[model samples]
Target: MALLELEGVTRRFGALVALDQVAMAVEEGEVRAVIGPNGAGKTTLFNVITGTVKPSAGTIRFAGESIGGQPSHHVCRLGLSRTFQITALFPEMSARENARLAAQARHARRWQPFGGAGVFRQAAALADAALEQLGLTSIGDTPAGLLSHGDQRLLEVAMAMAQQPRVLLLDEPTQGLSVEETAQAVDTLARFLQASRMTVLLVEHDMEVVFRLAHRITVLHRGAVIADSTPDAVKADPAVQDAYLGGFA
Candidate 1:
């Protein structure tokens, strides 16, 4: 069975259909990229899969369990984690602290009156490991707000990873980054993927990054899938070219 599956999923906002009978399946350890022009329902798809937005219709399954409309926190606890397009961090907190909090969320006793010192220690270890994986160990003590924008982006990814999720959804991870920063983030992520073989569903505008990391590309246009295939195949597809990749190919 596919690790993540969405069948005939639809979402509407009044008269507007943000997602129209979308269907896709992501295999275990597969890196699937979802790309499109603005307002093509890319982010909405992520929100729905992550349970931030309830689907107007259809079913979503992760590890063969129905999860549609279950709620964000519940979905997250089921081993689905994601990073947002906009960096969301506690600016005043140190990088390590920020990551530690995310790790703690995965602990079963996190809500207990006294989760205990062991829980905090374990969370710290996981956080530090995530930071190291993202090459942010040196700046672990720095306030998240003081880090460079590139580092901040990387930090958000590290925080997500600290949860040790089975599926990671990255929404425009390299958005607002300079060329150099983008390259750095991509390289770091590439290395992590190689080591972890993590399943990822990415929504990225940078075609270069999308092509480099994706095993399969699924293109969306006007709230529906226009093309879904290998990167080269999708690039050469006439429909994809006319709709979004006119000059990128």
Candidate 2:
């Protein structure tokens, strides 16, 4: 069964029809990229899946169970997590502290903030592991606000990883990064996903990052899917070429 499925999903903001009968299926352990022009409802799709917005119609299923309209926290508890287009981090806290917070939140069912030394130790270990995996051990003690933008982005990923989510939704992970930084972030992400085997659905505008990391691409236009295929097929698709990739040349 597909790990995450959206069938005939639609969301309308009063007079605005943001998404229309969208259907998508993400297989387990695959990196699926969602791409579109600015107003194509890519962010809306992520919001709906992550339970930040309820779908006006249709069903969303993860692991074959309906999850549409569930609360955001509930959705997150089900092993679904996301990072935003803007960097989301505790600026005043160190990178390791930010990660530790996420780890504690994830294991809160067993965590006691003021109760035991062992719980804090476990959370710290998880955060350390996540930082090491992202190659951020050197800056683990640096304040997030002091880190470079690219490092801030990586720290966000580390926080998400500390959640240990089975399905990760990354929205514009490389946005605002320099060319060199973008390349580095792409490499780190590809390696991390491969090592963890986490199912990923990312919304990205950078065609290079999308083509480099995604096993399949789903193109959205006017809040609807215009193309869904392998990277090569998507690049060759006339419709995708006209609507989205025309500028790539």
- Model 2: lowest-lDDT 10 consecutive positions: 109-118
Model 2 per-residue lDDT tens digits across residues 1-249? 899999999999998989999999999999999999999999999999999999999999999889999998888888898899998899999999999988888777756655677778888998999898888999999999999888888888888888888898999999999999888888988888878888999999999889888999999999899999999999998899899899473
Pairs of residues clashing in candidate 1: none
Best model number under TM-score: 1
Q: Can you give the TM-score per candidate against the true fold?
A: 0.97, 0.95
List candidate 2 stretches off by more than 4 Å. Answer: 110-116, 247-249
| Global local distance difference test of model 1 | 0.93
What is residue 25's positional error in candidate 1, in angstroms?
A: 0.4
Q: What are the per-residue Cα lDDT tens digits for candidate 1 across 1-249?
A: 999999999999999999999999999999999999999999999999999999999999999999999999889889999999999999999999999999888665554555677778888999999999888999999999999988999899899999989999999989999999899989989898888899999999999999999999999998999898999999999999999988798
lDDT value, candidate 2, whole model: 0.91
Where model 1 places Cα greater than 4 Å from the true spot, the runs are 108-114
Once model 1 is optimally superposed onto the true structure by TM-score, how far is the C-alpha of residue 147 displaced, in angstroms? Answer: 0.8
